[model samples]
Target chain A: MKWESVSDFFAMGGYGLYVWGSYLVAVLCVIGEIIAIRIRRRTLYKHLGLRKRSILRGEK
Target chain B: MTINWFKYASPASFYFLAGRMIPYFSIAAIIFLIVGLYIAFFSAPTDFQQGEAYRIIFIHVPAAWMSMFLYVVMAFWAGIGLAFNTRLSSMVASAIAPTGAMFTFLALWTGAWWGKPMWGTWWVWDARLTSELILFFLYIGFMSLQAAIDDPRRADKAGAIIALVGVVNIPIIYFSVQWWNTLHQGASVSLIQSPKMATAMLSGMLIMALAVWMYSIVMILIRARLIILERERHTAWVSELKEGVLE
Candidate 1:
């Protein structure tokens, strides 16, 4: 609402690069953390499943 | 009816509780983030002095606050675990390190980005910046210390000592601006004084802070649940959980 056009919003009154740079990295960090956790959860589930199968087979 | 608070102290109960709560927290985090970003870019008026560069404050301030706050929380849990020998408490302490480290990195990164245009330099060897960098190292130290030990109990105890000792740095990082004439500006929002910014700007920062807070809770709980699964894999309950999942 403050900007008159799309270019004005993106230009950010000449501080655009710094503002966007900060936000871009912040977003990437969040995404990276989420993906890392998901991978961890999947691996954990796989390990647990294998352990359960081994237990059913009377193996330690 | 008395609700037994300690009932949830066991990882088993806490894991399920966290699982149920994650959805709600995730929703809250999303909503707050959207609203906060809208207010930050659209609603809040541009700063007259700093122009648009000041917009970085929303992320930088919140990340810096969370970085320090999470370290304290991590240390508190670690200390409790050390005192009481609580497994879940130690697991929580370990779970918080990565997220704390992430925010610390964000704070420094965003600080550098904001600094480039405002301060005419990327970084300065100032007290606040140096202390925050040390906090990042502390997080890495805690995580690596735990990772190096084969035994979980030993790792937790060792990590707890470091975490508790590292608590001294937090207050230093917080008061650095006031204590030293640092390049970084002093806190705009303080407990004893009115905020120095416009209402919309203040609200946006606060809302972003809430969004980050909720997001932290979700990440910590998720990681804690994973730690529980890892450590408790030998237990019958974990085996039962596996069965429940398979079905």
Candidate 2:
């Protein structure tokens, strides 16, 4: 808010790189965890479905 | 009525309980994060010295605290699993590792960011930072070792051992600033004493810490659910649950 313009906010009084970079990394980590959890969930569901089908078919 | 807390420690019971909990924790985490960010950016006074740079502390300190807290939690679960041979304990331990590692990375990254302006360096080999880096590696090592093993039981045992060993590093990380003269600042807040920071600043930090705590629980619960579904796919309970869901 103190910044004269949008660029000044990004500049972060010359520590912009460090400040923004750190926040960026933190954001990315959260996103990464969400994606990983979703992927793992899908895989688990698939495995469970396959196992159930095999059991119903008496193939296990 | 005796509520058996230990019963929930069973994977099946934990699975359902975690399912019920995930939504609550997620909502709580979101609310806290919004409130925390609002107070941090708007209410907390700008530092007399650091100006805007001090704002980063809101996120940095909470992430740092969660990183350490999660590791201790993971190790605690690992120990419980090892001692009691509880399937859910191992699953919980496994579920927490990646999240813990992510927080560790966040803490380190934020610390580097905070350090650059205040300490005149983007990176330092101070005891705190070095020990934190080691914690990150320990997380990776535990996950990798678990993945490499073919047997789940064996993987759990191996991961538990590694996590227990890594627990030693946690105290070292905590005491690093106190034990050595480092560029990193000492703790502003401790359990035994009132925080050194202004009330507004401390409030923001506490809110952020609560946000991180809730987020960790939600993530771990989601992960543990998946672990239970995988490990118990052959069980009658899972089969019935799958049927109920499908219908």
Candidate 3:
């Protein structure tokens, strides 16, 4: 609220680049982790499903 | 009744326990972060020297602390895995590495931000900063080494060794200010003495530190659960777990 406008908020008293850059990197890292975990889960589930199906067919 | 501490060390047991713990840690992290940010922004007075720029310390110091703390934890778990050949240990270590690296990067980034306003530069090669950069590289090296190996057991062992070797750098990073002529200020709130800052500032920093700790625990628990599911996919317990969750 101290920042008068959107532009002022981004400016951060001339520390716009450094402050925003740090925050951006941190947020992106968290986002990356979430994406990586979801992908890993999907791959693991598919692999397990395939293996289970193969074993079932072999048993048949 | 005695609790079986070692039981939870088992991958399966840890999976369930970490699941339960995650929500608690997540809630605590959120509460503490909200409170800490409020205090940091509103209650703590601005510094005469650094003006509003000093507010960055609230996040920066906590991030730096967590960066170091998580690495030590990762190495500890890695050592356990190597000694006992336990799946859970390796999983814990792997879970912590990425988060540790993130915090390390945050520390450096915030430090650079703070530096630009006070020191008139975006970057510095001070002793503390240099050692912290090495810490970041160490995290990347550990993750890469683990990913490169085919055998999970062999990968854990190799990662453990690298982590142990990297442990030597932690002490160097902590003591760099005392050991060398560094632009970074020496510790103001060391364990040996009362903090030099005002009570409000110290309280805000401590609250932020607690929030960071909670956040790390929650993140690590989530990661470790994912590791458990991946590693234990062939086990009957995992099949049961999937069935129960799907239901």
**Going through the candidates in order, what is the number of backbone clashes in each?**
0, 0, 0
lDDT, residue B102, candidate 3? 88
lDDT by residue (A9-32, candidate 2, tens digit) is 678677677767877787888999
Sort the predicted structures by lDDT, highest score first: 1, 2, 3
lDDT of the structure predicted as candidate 2: 0.85
Deviation (Å) of B148 in candidate 2: 0.9
Q: Write the per-residue lDDT of candidate 2 for residues B1-247, one digit (tens) a residue.
A: 9888688977767777777677889999999999998888668877888977888888888988888889999999988898989888999999999899998888888887788778878788889999999999999999999999988888999999999999999999989999999888898798899778899999999999999999999999888888788888888877767666422
Task: Give the Cα error of residue B153 in candidate 3, in Å.
Answer: 0.5
In order of appearance, the predictions have TM-scores of: 0.95, 0.91, 0.89
Instruction: Report the TM-score of candidate 3, chain A only.
Output: 0.76
Per-residue alpha-carbon lDDT of candidate 3 for residues B59-122, written as tens digits (9 for 90 to 100): 8899999999999999999999999888899999999998899899999988988888788887
Candidate 3, residue A38: how far the Cα is off, in Å: 3.0
The candidate that wins on TM-score is: 1
C-alpha lDDT values of all predictions: 0.92, 0.85, 0.83
lDDT of 1 by residue, A1-60 (tens): 798999999898999999999999999999999999989977886876664433322111
Alpha carbon deviation, residue A43, candidate 1 (Å): 1.6
Error of 1 at B202 (Å): 0.4
